[model samples]
Target: MTTIDHAVVLGGSIAGLLSAAALAPRAHRITVVDRDPLPLEGPDAQVARRGVPQGDQIHHLLMRGQERIEELLPGIGDELLALGCEKYDDVADFSQFVDGAWRMRIQSDLKVTMFRRPLFEWAIRRRVLALSNVTVVKGMAVGLLASSDGARVSGAKVRGAPGGTLAADLVVDATGRGSRSPFWIEDLGYERPVERHVRIYMGYSTWTVRLPEGALPKGLAGISASASPANPFGVAIRPCGNGLHDVAAYGMAGHYPPDDLDAMAGFFEELDSPVIADVMKKAVPASEIVPYRMPGNQRRMWEDLPRRPENLVVVGDAVTSFNPIYGQGMTMAALGAGVLGDALAEAGTLDGLAETVQARLGPLAQVAWDLAVGADSVYPQAEYENVEPPSARDRDRARAQSAAQSAEGAVRVAMRATALYMDPAYLGSPVVQETIDRWLTSGHKPAPEVTDPTDPPDVTPGVVRAADLLEPATAAGRLAG
Candidate 1:
């Protein structure tokens, strides 16, 4: 265990509770400070705090993350499953049309648990608060307090009923996107961290339904991906308490799901596919449609900032947030806390924990970040286009817009090609669509069709059936007519 004395966490969301849980073993004392009074365990009551804006949404915790949580807080996943969080093999259990092409569910080591964000986090927070070394304090952290040298954060100054201050050996910011740690650091005379934004003009709105848990569609436990690029969408037959299933209708704002029953009907009718819309068709409304607007993905350059003060670090969405379409936020944050635990152990129970923590989280967070930007950068929305919008005037506007649309089309082609090219027998791949999505997201050279990979490298995309090796793919019905 690291010999650190006290670690103060500034947010009480999943990230905050998980951080406390991870650090509790190392720190002599850990306090989780939050602006709102987090909910208690009960099905009859669950209210969103003023602090947690998108608290009540159909959120999915990736299976890999559930594994991490099980490792950190044993039996936590099972406990969640018992508490209405439905489990399914996310990528492996469900076949996906990811890059394009209906991807067969290859038997892999990945799974996911679909749950309402508040209930899941509340469960974890309860477990965290149970730790003898941990405590949850109700207050809003306004700023940080540093040592005499001001080289490291000693604690935080919080605003509460009477306003107060709490000092600690280390300070972790678990606050979500609106975190002020960067500005606070600048005030402490350090270079402000840079930020990256991938604007997709996305919004998530959920409608509850009273479909019997057993009657829900098969393979309906998690998100069923949509194939349309213009409407890259997600549908969840999420399990809530008491046999309740939340048939969440999620889409980008320009094509947002409506709250009224008629609009709701129209919403599903317009989806790229009829699968999700059909499910919503039979579902009985348990509650009014809840609409929440969440804009572009914003990630702080916390890791890139050199000369970070001692006893100070940021974790969770404050550090980096990905496009929700990936359903990686909770899992990624849990993994981050797990890394923090391992880092504290490696730093040898010493004063350098803050610096080491960020280093460990960078690689993990970057994986999600790179994937999000690579996809979101290609969105067709006018505002989310590249950093530099067209400054040219006159008919050039139409020309540039047309060119952008063409590039976007090429992007989808590339994504589809990437999906198809991997299939050894899929006529042609590389040349036509490779990297089209990237080009669409980020203006680049026009995508051109290229020859398929060197005849056939050792590996191909489809499931390698025993029948495939001896004959052409047609025998397996994997090839086009």
Candidate 2:
């Protein structure tokens, strides 16, 4: 046997649990530490714990994130669907408008899960616990126990029963954005990690409703309004729930939704994207007008750190967190855990695992970082997060200004190109190459897709049933049934 004994995880959120899954098959025992008592399997109410306030926003599982979930947890996605989490194909259902055009591009067979953030995190946590080797315990983590050599972390000092300690061969930090690991390190006489934050002042007031459970008028569609002169707003109404709907209104920094109901209505009426306003204008809206805000796009430069605790690794938002508008945090964290697993499997020692994960994750981090920073740069007060130098490429902004300036069409092209490239390999595909050529006006093809504004999907589409790509997940639930 390989004989790796124990792995300890801090933070029981999405990143932590996913890391647990990656380590499950290899580690003999795993301990997950969190301040909140973990949620039991099945349905539950949302509870606020520590400082994680964004737990209520609409959390979307991007196509890439969904594929990772299926691979690691097997059938948990289906369990989510059966419990009322919504799963739908992106191209078919999403309403996208950018660069002055709508995209009617056919669905690329990508199924995304739209679920309550807490519910989604809970499902993954359950899977982590399902492993006989994993145990969930509630406690606060204070600091790392450093080896005398000062180059390695041996374990952690947690706030368990009056200052308890847990020893491990590997200690993973999935503790989220507010994580105090770095400060704790400095307290132990180490250099603090540097950060790059995209300055964006944003607040969101979200609302969710039960769309009559069985059928609806139209499929789900999302709309976005750009901050550029020709366009100044955006709205997205995506398919969600067991057959329900979620609608959220966002504004650039100070323009976001306010707490006053009357102001809320006016904001909705005048939102950048037209679709959300239309839905809110109708329907008996469900849920309260929940409000939340993320002040900055923060990233800690752990890769460049002069020294890092050998056995310690920080995954998830603790490393980087982007603006929610892009919906990339969850996905980024999942990919991070995947990287952690790969490092553990190959590395002979847990020593320096944190730095290794950071270096390996540099590419994914760059992709998400630029996309967010580019968008934030267009908004007022966005300059402060000066993490990336001003010379960075906002290809869409650059090309749109010089080459393609149509708000509706250009934005769609940008979104489409980016989505296709997420496959990474598709960048080399002939179809993708042609689209790029056409997009740059090679043959001047009419923009590939001009999608209609959509209504919500029906509850019984049977589209999400097992035969679908979501089959890996859907079938798991049916088997359990």
TM-score of 1: 0.76
Candidate 1, residues 1-481, lDDT tens digits: the string is 5577888999998888888888887888998899777657565236556677676666666544776788888988788788876665432344232332233333222345666766777778778888999877888898889876779888898887234888888888999888999988888888977876667666667756776443433344433444235665555556655566666666653556655676677766655445556566667887776766667777776677778788887888998886565566887778878878888877755577777888777766765564455455454562432234323331222222112222333322322222111122321233322233334345443223211111101111233232322233333232221
TM-score list, all predictions: 0.76, 0.81
Q: Tens digit of lDDT per residue, candidate 2, span 205-281? A: 66676544323334444334333424344454555565556666665656566754556666656544455555565
Q: Alpha carbon lDDT of residue 23, candidate 1?
A: 89
Clashes in each model (backbone N, CA, C under 3 Å)?
10, 29
Which regions of candidate 2 are displaced past 4 Å?
1-3, 41-51, 161-163, 212-218, 221-233, 272-275, 385-481
TM-score of 2: 0.81
